[model samples]
Target chain A: MSDLFPEEVRTERLRLECESVADADLGERYASMNETAIEDGELAYVPIEPFEHLQEARDFVAQREDRMESGDAGTYVVRPRDGEDGAGYPAGEAELFAVWDERTAFMTFGLRKRFWGRGYSGERAAALLRLAFERLGVELVSVTHLVGNENSRRAIGKYVDRFDGERVGRFRNQHVIDGEPRDVVRYEVSKADYEASGERPDCEFVEERADGGDGA
Target chain B: MHVGVANLDCLWENRRVHTGVSLYRPYWGRGYAGERARALLSVTFDRLDLDVASVAHFEGNENSKRQMEGWVEDFGGREDAYIRNAVPRDDGDAEPWNLRSYSITAADYRDAGGAPEVELDPENVPEPTSEPTDLDRANDGGDGA
Candidate 1:
């Protein structure tokens, strides 16, 4: 289980890279995010700091290393094929994170406003599901949607099966964005359901090799 | 048959009284159906520690009824509890229906042989945690969506 985290995942259409401090303008880019943009998006919550400054974002990524080591946290960058042009959104569609046992991952996608109507969200979600199951070996994965988020709910429903009955629950104010202290609906997918979905489990994966002379 | 997964999700395995049997047409007349059913009997009678296993067949499924009859000769005897429409085949598109049952015991399974062994990786089992944590993580096996 400790070996579950992978630094990068390259699917057919997009590349999912876990962000570190070295990555581009994460701080300033994330800082540039306005509260309105986040509220409109119905994200978990907008951070207190107005701008996502370099040090702030770097420290965030650095804190992730500590969290991950203790099996408490993880974050990844979604890089879509269409490069991030002028808009500040990260190129990829979304990211998955599991803090502790990593039983199941919770995912959130970030397709830019321009890419809204495209079908990339579901496609990328399926790819991420594969990573969680075959790669990370999770038994289940669940997603939460803010009440009234019909678009996100529909997108999520079209993806995973096992649609466990929804339980209204509360999440963090700043950590999750659906707004302050709001109740959300939960949906989940179990390994049994995912395997039963008739999707192919036989995709060939090219393991990202590490540098260095190796003669194992 | 594809054995629609939807049926399983409905908790088919937990049903107190349900029986389903299928055989490939290509493998007919080879007693494969009987063998298939005896396998389930072994699971119920042996591994499940059930005192008896109930099996059934209807008027149209003579092959299946015959299979159950054979098992009785080996270890037990049977009597009809009631004539019932276990599965109605009255519909034009449906198949035939007849019903019968049997009881197999753990003792019988032990006498015949044993159930197959299963192994699971102990490490993968997640430890449950209280529900108040904010990280979507508990002691371990956490989620944060």
Candidate 2:
């Protein structure tokens, strides 16, 4: 897992690049994005609190780097490849958190308000799933979203199969949204299922090296 | 003779735990396994304050599967996943055994009237033996199903 990190994944329109300590400024921007309400009156549901200062953002990046180094998690920043004027600086982030036994991982993705409705969420999520199933050799990937989060439900529904009914257990009132207890719907996608579906995203992963050589 | 003991593996971050129980062959038909499971479930949900609990049994282990299903019916639990070829058999040459996982939440446990009071009668309890018996030999199969 450590050898797989610090790599670059290129989708058709988005670049899902691994995050490092050098991306502290981008982390600060992400934190700021979460602090403000979006156009839909929805606040980003983040496990951690919004960063109060640049130092906090830097700390967050540092911790993420440590987790990546330990092979416990991976974080990627989603951005446009062309870097055109109209293109956003950094759309949002995608993560494969809580990797266990090299076979299972928890996936999450978020996009800023300005970046929504541009098909960026689905693109980044597909690329992240490729990274999990192809490069990381993970067998099962699980995701959970707030029940009322329609945007998240739609985005995640495109990439994975729903694991509700008798197939998966529900965690009732696992989160509190707007001072009310909300159930989180759990979803999962197995490597076999993903491979059988024959729905591969147009993505390529390139390993980066400390030297000036392309580690493909 | 003593049958088996049920235990819990604590996973606090997910607010969940894994339950395991193994019984000797001589005590298989008896209700010792179920009795032990009830006590462990009480400790897991009532005392530990966990959100969910899970258990798994290997393929071809009908007795173990039946025991787990009984808990699901009692606690309104669900069969989570049917993991194919997940558990390897004791013999390396044998095909890997499929795994069936079941999970129960604390809310469901309460909805099923919760764990019953487990009473132990000292007079009926079997005394521990210093020498290894058939129970010890049976337990050598594995930690749990």
Candidate 3:
């Protein structure tokens, strides 16, 4: 793990573990979840298509681990603390990747279909924003979603507004999704703006997983 | 005379283009930057068919601030954001640049009368003559007005 972030971070209702390739269970579950990510248009806005095979997903997990080891970015597996269905089975993934040259970082996350509509995005966003501003000491933290993703548009809008961030603009052709360029809506919160906005959602850094054991 | 270079950089997966200029100190306030910017806007909207054109200037750069503001006002754009520590320093000791950014969409460009009325005809050229040209006079330190 990068020294910038803890092994685990938590919001009020969610626990995000920094993902690693060494965690065989996580790689297996992550790959399985992504295999059907495109079903029912769940990952339509995401740039990559559904993972055709396990190796593709495993390769992705290894890449994320490499990014963390390089000290440039961190990817985490998000799980619910207390839920009846899919409580702790890699409900989603959240990441805070630094744009080191800009002294900034960007947030990205995606949830499984069963995990949607619960405001978990906002929850993880709070933790990630806290990590970006307080832990990483970055100047700005940004989040972007496809222009047509209404769920993300609402979720990100609500939290970013709460954090006193501004809508940078709707940038065109921001991503190439399945060989077609797509637009993205971007929002940003500078450290000064985030601090001036005062506390909103609270987050905590933890030395161990919420389960008090290693490797989900 | 190789006074400067103008740039239109792509951003957002080639959806938008950001304009910039680097002029020699002696050519700083000659309105050349403005002329180049107008041409770039034509390329951005009229020729390239891009959706947006953006410009940014580091904080405390009055010349760039004025220039960027002029484009925003003339092109019916707005100040989009104030980004802090937006660019890292190469010197290792200096601080990153804070930027004031602005943008104009295609619709806004059209509302602002679209591209300026500047035409180019490089294919039609006049052969050089012995008569002194205005550029030659300017090179000789004359006003060339």
Candidate 4:
């Protein structure tokens, strides 16, 4: 297993940092936003139950940190670049997880309702794709959205090559939205497709090491 | 002793299996690959009662591409995924090859009259060679890339 992705990525308006235990407060905030989104029927694909307490958020962050250490997955906290200095809450999350032998990974992201419609989702997703292809050497990245999630579809479409048709599969009631089962739409982008799109995020990656050595 | 071998990697949870086949160079172009694939598909669909069976090959491997096409045309398989530069070549200078994956469902397999029959002759099987070929390593592990 290799730690190929950098610790932090900065776009023009957002900074995507690897989630850590120290970011428990941010995690708590994210959990609250997720709960709101779910309750409002704006999000339906999340499998886990909403967090009831801050402790759950801390535990989630700890588990993510462990997965990052094992090189299996990573979750990034999306925050404003010019936001407050310390203990700032995350506006959203962009995650690349379920890495398969460093060859492929799954992408998922969301923005807080307050941050929606700001074009930040596209920026953050582009940055994550760049990290997946350039840093992790992944050949393909996949994303899925439940049917009727037009916002997610649009956000993910920004990075995908439209020439390749999306694959639709029946989840057989996998997602219960408004008490009805819905199918899922899956989209995949290959490294070649990403390179061909010529859409690169204006971002800087900052590598942070735990051993006090400059990441080379 | 072996003229070739076929493999079925069952993903029981997914109700699918991944198939792979390899033959000695001298045995190539004899339609053995297709026959072995049919037999394996039988095991996957009939014996294992699996829902889907999938296979993949590098883009440049015309033999494999042709065989997969045969299965698709005859057994109603469909192209499932194509990942660019997914299969790294053994030669360091050569570029990584694109991978084309295909899948067939048990319903399709049954509609195609199950699996084709292949004759087996244990008496003519050759002794195993000492040297390990790239295909051997690929078939043994490492995602059969």
RMSD of 4: 8.2
lDDT of 2 by residue, B1-145 (tens): 3456555676555566677877657888787777777876777677778787778898678998888798777889887666544544554245556677778888898999886686544355333333323544555644554
True contacts kept of 1: 0.00
lDDT (CA) per prediction: 0.48, 0.66, 0.76, 0.67
List model 3 lDDT by residue over A1-216, tens digit each. Answer: 568777788787888887666664645565556655446887778765667777777877787778778888777878887653666667788888997777889998998878789899998998888888888888889888887899999999999888998887765555777766677778888888889999656888875455443433
Q: What CAPRI class is candidate 4?
A: incorrect
The CA lDDT at A152 in model 2 is 80
Name the regions of candidate 3 deviating beyond 4 angstroms: A34-37, A82-84, A178-183, A196-202, A208-216, B10-13, B45-49, B90-93, B105-117, B120-145
Residue-wise C-alpha lDDT for candidate 4, range A151-194, written one tens digit per residue: 87787666564323244332322344554544456677777877
Instruction: Point out where model 4 deviates above 4 Å.
Output: A1-7, A26-37, A40-43, A46-49, A52-56, A67-74, A80-91, A96-106, A110-119, A130-151, A161-200, A204-216, B88-94, B116-145
Give the 10-residue window scoring lowest on summed lDDT in candidate 4 chain A: A165-174
Interface RMSD of each candidate, angstroms, one decimal: 22.7, 7.1, 3.2, 7.8
Best by lDDT: 3
Top TM-score prediction, candidate number: 3
TM-score of chain A, cand. 2: 0.79
Q: Which residues of candidate 2, in runs, are more than 4 Å off?
A: A1-3, A23-44, A71-73, A83-88, A97-106, A161-184, A209-216, B9-18, B44-53, B58-60, B83-99, B105-107, B114-117, B120-145
lDDT string for model 1 (B1-145, tens) is: 3211100011112222123455435656776555555555554444343344444566556776677677654554343332222344545134324345554444555675543443323465323332222322221332322
Q: State candidate 3's TM-score.
A: 0.79
